[model samples]
Target: MTTFTSFTFLLLPFVVFHVANAAIFDIRNNCPYTVWAGAVPGGGRQLNPGQSWSLNVPAGTKGARIWPRTKCNFDGSGRGRCETGDCNGRLQCQNYGMPPNTLAEYALNQFNNLDFFDISLVDGFNVPMEFSPTSGGCTRGIVCRADINGQCPNQLRAPGGCNNPCTVFKTDQYCCNSGSCGPTSFSKFFKDRCRDAYSYPKDDATSTFTCPGGTNYKVVFCP
Candidate 1:
C-alpha cells in the first residue's frame, strides 16, 4: 500500500510472454514419435537393389532407422546360416572388432519403438531394419542396379546392389601391420586432452579419425 513500483509492473508482461512461449514449445516438441510415409508396416513384400523407400519420423529424433543385422562372409564349406556358422558366423568378429551394434540398436529402439522388423520377411536378409520418409525415388518392377558412384563398388552386379531404406556407403579397410583391416588399438593421450577412435563412412564422405599422441587419419576409398 505504501508503494506501487512502475518498474515491477512494466516487467510483468515480458515475464508472462516468455513463460507462454516456453509452454507452446513444450507442447509442440512433446511426442517422441512422428508419422511416417512409405509401404505400410509389414507390407514390404520385396526389396530390390537400387530401390527406394521413405519413412517420416519425429523432428526431434536423430537419423532414422537402425540396422542390427550384420553383413556376413560365409565360409565356402559352412552350412550358410550366419548365426550358426563357425566363429559365430557374424560378418565381422565379436566385440570391439565387430561393427557398431549398440549404435544401431539404440537407433532402432528409439525409432521403431522397440518393434522388430525382419528384413528376411520383407524379401531381404534377416537383419534389423527401419525406414525414413526423408528419402524419395521411383517404386517399380524389374529392379535395376543403380549407378551411384562411391556406393556400389561392385559395378558388375545388376539388380543386386543396395537395398531401399538401407545403403552400404563404404567398406573401410584399416591398414595395419597385421595386414587385416580394423581398429587395432584404443588410446587416450596428451594428458587426456584428446580421445580418439575410428568411424565408418556415411553420406559418401569418409570418417574423420583422430588417435592418441596426435595421430590423425581420414578413411579414403580406392576404386
Candidate 2:
C-alpha cells in the first residue's frame, strides 16, 4: 500500500528537519481546520484553516497518520467532541464516510509540496466529522473518524459523573478501582481491581491512564 503522510503547520512558524512530504487539508474557508501527519518537532499551535505547510515525515518512521485536532473533544464539559454539525448540537461528533487523503497527498495536491504522493478520493466525498485510527496504532492514536470504535470503553469517564479518576473504567481497571492512583476508596474494589499489579505515575498530577486491551484503547485520566 502507499505510505501515509501528514503535517501540523498552523498560522505560526513550524519546521520539520526530517525526510518526508507535506499534505494540506485546508478547511479555512469551509471549516477552519488543518491536519498534518509527519514528524513535526513542535506538537501544534494556533493553526489557521486556509494556510498551508509541509509535513516532514522521517524516512524510517514506523507507523504514522494525522487528522484535525478539533474532531475530538476531551474536555470534561462534553461539548468538545463537536457532535451537532459544527458544535451545533449536544451529542458527540461522529466520523463517517470514506477515508481522508494522506497528509502528504493533501498537502502536495493543494499546496506546492513535491516530495509527496497523491491519493484520490471520490468526488464530493466528505469524511465524517469524527474519525480515528483504531486498527493501525498510528500517530496521535486517533483520527477524525467518528464512531465508538475509536473511543476506548473506560479510557474516558462517562458524561454522567464528573471527571473523577476513581470511576470504574475498563481502560485502567486497576487504577480506576484502586484509589491508590486516583481518589477512589482503597477498599475491595481497589484490591479486586489492581492489587499486586505494578503501577506508576504517568505524569505529575498523579494522572495515569493505561491500555488493558489492544494498543488502541488509551486509558486516559480526565481531571
**Most accurate candidate by TM-score:** 2
The alpha-carbon deviation from the true structure for residue 157 of candidate 2, after best TM-score superposition, in angstroms, is 7.3
The residue ranges of model 2 lying beyond 4 angstroms of the native Cα positions read 1-30, 33-42, 63-67, 70-168, 172-223
How well is each residue in 1-223 modelled by candidate 1, as lDDT tens digits? Answer: 0011112123366544432221000001111222111121111111222222322322122122222222333455432222211123423323211222211210111221221111111111122222111111211111111132124224211132222121222323322223334321111111021111112112111111111111111110110
**Evaluated with lDDT, which candidate comes out highest?**
2
Alpha-carbon RMSD to native, per candidate = 19.7, 16.6
- Prediction 1 TM-score vs. true: 0.20
The lowest-lDDT stretch of 10 consecutive residues in candidate 1 is 22-31
Each model's lDDT: 0.19, 0.24
- Candidate 2 per-residue lDDT over residues 163-201, each given as its tens digit: 122223333532332333432232222122222211121
* TM-score, one value per model: 0.20, 0.23
Error of 2 at 161 (Å): 16
